[model samples]
Target: MNNNNNSICNKSVHKKNVQHPLLINFGENQDGDGFDEFILDTFRFVGGRRYHNVSSSKYFLPNDLPEMDRLEKQHYLFLHIWRNNFSAPVREKIITKRKSSLHMAFEYPSAIFIGVDISPIFPSEQKKPDNATFLQNMLDGLPFEDDTFDFVYQRSLASAISEDQWKNDVIYELHRVTKPDGWIELMEPEFLFSKETDAPNCHKFSRALLGFLATLGINGFISSQLENILTSTKLFKNIHCEERSTPIGQWGGRLGEMMCNDYIESAEACKPALSQFIGISHEKFDSMLENIRMEINQNRLYYKTRRFYAQKA
Candidate 1:
């Protein structure tokens, strides 16, 4: 969520003559612990209304998954999980830190977290001692030495790296820094989500999402197949994976209700930005979202989510 670093990074990479004020303001507002506090407060206010007794999800990093040959990427999973499990603030913190700590009660308190989309400006202040770090330097790649971390984690950087070599290099860097016997974890979701009883073409929003990502040469549609990527690396063992389907609009329960409501609100809030960047009309967007709500209300709209976990050899 730290925009300063990313803006600089983006500007440096693009080397363009333009400076975007919205992007600049977004960066400034997204810095430090205060931004996280805002996001957490928002989540508590809205998310509390949806589900009360849900336990924190288990933490997973990008390097963990089964089926090393599957063609799934990490960032898509991170965003889907964030949208499903987190509010804007909580997700901002999670992405900016590139890691998450859900089990402080576990033995290695400092070593446990989910690292994805971590920005250089925001250190891992969500946890005590702050043991993890992610470098955003496109030129420098990752900043860690070989075997520097017990786990390597990331997701949702598809737009940031357009070339296969850059992606491969980043993965190679991650593998080089990961300690032996450590673990790699990844979660990915297909750009589209659908309910079982949805009407024809109701998943248009998801489809458009896929189209946008495809334009960037990003496989935005990766979901439930992360294990293939892990297996291809041949650096991990003891792979474990699971998949869950959540209803989109129906009153499946508190979580569903919260997710639906948030999705609506966030979609509306981002309408202008979406239009500016993606050229989609609000009317069309709302119609699609409304369709999803109807499907959910009828208890037929559902979306698939996948998880992957693996340990190093």
Candidate 2:
């Protein structure tokens, strides 16, 4: 990401203090590609995991390799549940002739891609294909001009962006960039299982998660509520929304097992942040997670996920 023309934009200036030598310090180069430098801080260790160093970001989970693996497993669970590589309906709306896309699903020979993320989670310039370009920028402030894309797709960011940001900043930015009649799709999983769960610890985790999100002014049910949220915005019409339930224990078979791991891993990742939020020690948090893991298997736990695909008015 050190290339002169790289698109990882800088939003917040990071402190130079490193608690561990293994901490990643992606030095900034503002002149490269006219995009600001974006620093991904995973080296700052806390509660035995890593998290973003950006003070303005409200993401509650860790950003280390283990967390990525957990997310990948969750992605696999989605593929298994939907029996497709993606949840959006882009076949006729896109992937036909040559098209310019931001965060597209297909790499059709004629299609060009510009991906945006808060971190350099994608392949570097030397490793990525020529058709794909990436930019590291905060979601609230996109670098593109208005009417810049034929399609825009964002997934799994319900935690990273708050309700206020969605209602006031992020959605408007998306509306501003999307061309009229173009498609915009977003997928967010409730991804939390504190409600309607039979397990005691899972209940505790749920209440804690709700309290944490409330403290940050984020909506806990954005997954199911996003369809109405988008409709209320008045920027888009013809909204297509879908919700799915996934099993979280052995009762759901292999899919359930994977879902179970996704649940526990996510809760565990929040240990560093949420434990403090609820005034608990690291050891007590671990005990709670262990009980949650076993209780889910015995209780037939399940959780809901939702996605919305809409078009600009």
Candidate 3:
């Protein structure tokens, strides 16, 4: 990364204080070096996981439902709750050099207005808009070259990556694809049982969910440690972190209701796995979730989501 170039870009953009428009292109680069073919191969080999684990399902709440529209609405609500319009400044520097095209990649493409995903659970019968393209591919082994994109963004992937993969493969891969002085943002939620605060049943549910995920070699609390994890790489600079509490029920207003719905749907989706690994019966699990919902409505328990971003140097 050129320090002088970055400093110039920063000064120019900060002076304007305008959000930069992102330019995203999903297809192969001008090089045409089998990047598209590699994406196809990855999708074929890395089929989506079968068991709907809670830890993973949080990334895509209501994972079992095939309704694309509802899922998209849920995602938009989530973004609104987190104040997506607050715009990270690092992205402005990346956008200043490009055209006004924006492309986003998602695991489930149906719900999003544009861009593509590895696969769509509910394939849309309607024609896709010109701005949207759907591609099937996995995150761990992206097909793009080093510095292919100006900005890279991923959210709620803690369940998809294990602790080892996070430290070794995932972070490095993200760094490799980002342009020098460009930005990458990761958003994730920490799942921990509330202790000594009067939410015992909710805590028990949280404990069981975390314990079950541990059997699969995933760390449920990884979100809380992301700052340390990314800083250790020493491959990035100007790292920024932000956290917000997501209220679960009506007490938290519209955002709370949406978050509560996400949590409920996430728990419901993981019912089968919870029953199998933790010996939690369907009836018992449903009852417990109801109690948790009540607790959320009463403002007794909440979960926190962390957003981290940095400039690759």
Q: Please tell me which predicted candidate would have the highest TM-score against the true structure.
A: 2
**Best candidate according to lDDT:** 2
Candidate 2 lDDT tens digits, 1-313: 1111123234443222111110000111111222125433323567667665666667657656687667656655775776643344555544532222322223453555566555445554554556566665453465545665666667677766677777766666666656687667776777466344567788888889878887887778778778877899999988898878887789889888878887888888888778899899989999999998888988866777776878889
How accurate locally, in lDDT, is each candidate?
0.40, 0.61, 0.53
**Candidate 3 structure quality by residue, lDDT tens digits, 1-313:** 1110211121211111111111132211111123444444332221232322222222332322332334455556656766552234643443322211122322213222222233333233243333343333343254445665556666656765678777877777767756888777777787862331466667777888888778767788899888899999999998889987665679677877877777776676667667566686788888988987776676545667788888898
Better of 2 and 3 by lDDT: 2
> What is residue 309's positional error in candidate 3, in angstroms?
0.3
Error of 1 at 247 (Å): 2.6
- Overall local distance difference test of candidate 1: 0.40
Rank the candidate models, highest TM-score first.
2, 3, 1
Q: How far in Å is the alpha carbon of 294 misplaced in model 1?
A: 3.1
lDDT of 1 by residue, 21-109 (tens): 01101111112333444443322222112111112211111111111111122222333444432222222322333322222112233
Q: Which stretches of candidate 1 lie over 4 Å from their true place?
A: 1-140, 155-167, 195-197, 265-280
> Would you list the clashing residue pairs of candidate 3?
118-136
Q: What TM-scores do the predictions have?
A: 0.56, 0.80, 0.70
Q: TM-score for model 2?
A: 0.80
Please identify model 2 stretches exceeding 4 Å from their true place. 1-43, 85-87, 96-107, 191-197
Lowest summed lDDT across 10 adjacent residues in model 1 is found at: 16-25
